[model samples]
Target: MAKKVVATLKKEGGSAMFTKVVKMTKSGGNGSYAFEERIVSKDSAKDFFSK
Candidate 1:
């Protein structure tokens, strides 16, 4: 099974511009894990903010 997490990106005013969903997987028994993040299609900030 995989674990999913949601993260929000906010501007200086504290308004959310985008949300990201991360997929996490446990690697070994040593408390190691891997993660993969993707932008939510309907809420991606890439088009609204400049890097």
Candidate 2:
């Protein structure tokens, strides 16, 4: 189940190693902005947002 994946990560301290990065991007051909979510390693969290 979905809980299993999350449970293991917590047990091994993997949750802290990962981060959620949300980015707002302009829609193609539209003047609207939307949010994008990504699960990235903590080390690259800044890079994801910088781009």
The root-mean-square deviation over C-alpha atoms between each candidate and the true structure, in angstroms, is 11.3, 1.4
lDDT of 2 by residue, 1-51 (tens): 989988988976799899899999998887899999999999999999889
Model 2 C-alpha RMSD vs. true structure (Å) is: 1.4
lDDT against the true structure, per candidate, is 0.52, 0.92
- List the candidates' TM-scores in order: 0.33, 0.80
- For 1-51, candidate 1 gives per-residue lDDT tens digits of 122222223335333444666666778878889886765544554543332
Off by over 4 Å in 1: 1-18, 28-31, 42-51
**Lowest-lDDT window of 10 residues in candidate 2?**
4-13
- Candidate 1 residue pairs that clash: none
If candidate 1 were superposed on the true structure by all CA atoms, what would the RMSD be? 11.3
Clashing pairs in 2: none
